[model samples]
Target: MTDQWVSFSKVGDAELVSLTGEIDLANSGEIGKAIVGRIKESGKVLIDLTTVSFLDSAGVRLLDALVGDLLGHGARTRLVVGERGAARMTLTLCAFREDVLTTDLERAAADLK
Candidate 1:
């Protein structure tokens, strides 16, 4: 089993959700819930995947759902994938929209404004 983890912090008007470890089938739902929960509470969210070491198809699905859910709620959301992060490969393979992708948490938060 992958040891997945997630942490959340407030940055200005956006909530930064930092994910670490491997995001796979076992934890993808929880990860999605945590992110959506915060978005429900804060309205603006920035997901930082810099510390994440692995991301599977499940992670891609979670991100896609997150964007759709956020759009339905009329909230802004951003995704940050560090240049050297492991999550990059999965994200790139999934072809997530460039508009929602950033390289740093700070940039993601700034753009959420």
Candidate 2:
């Protein structure tokens, strides 16, 4: 499935998936599945949430599951959640690991090294 909010690229050895716009109940499932289907989990990955403007409960759950699935499959995953960005508070409230979140895209990529 093609999602307008999702785009894929590569940064060094990591696969970069940048998400834009809002991610809510209506689209989070499809988005999560699309990502899981497209990414090979044996390497490094960076999920850039910096451009996301909204992250609802379903979106948080999608990210939590996606990150867990990737790590379980031996992939190192990092999330680019800017400190003052829209997704940050929701992630913080959901108690996502601080180590997995970063405010910079470059930092997210570097962490994969």
Q: Among these predicted structures, which one has the highest TM-score? A: 2
Error of 2 at 90 (Å): 0.8
What residue pairs clash in candidate 2, if any at all? none
Error of 2 at 38 (Å): 1.0
lDDT, candidate 1, 16-111, per-residue tens: 788888888989998777666656756888888888888888988988888778867877888899776688878887788878888888788888
Model 2, 5: alpha-carbon shift in Å?
Answer: 0.9
Candidates in order have lDDT scores of 0.80, 0.88
Per-model TM-score versus the true fold: 0.88, 0.94
Clashing pairs in 1: none
What candidate 1 gets wrong by more than 4 Å, as runs, is 1-4
| lDDT for residue 33 in candidate 1, whole number 0-100 | 75
lDDT of 1 at 110: 80
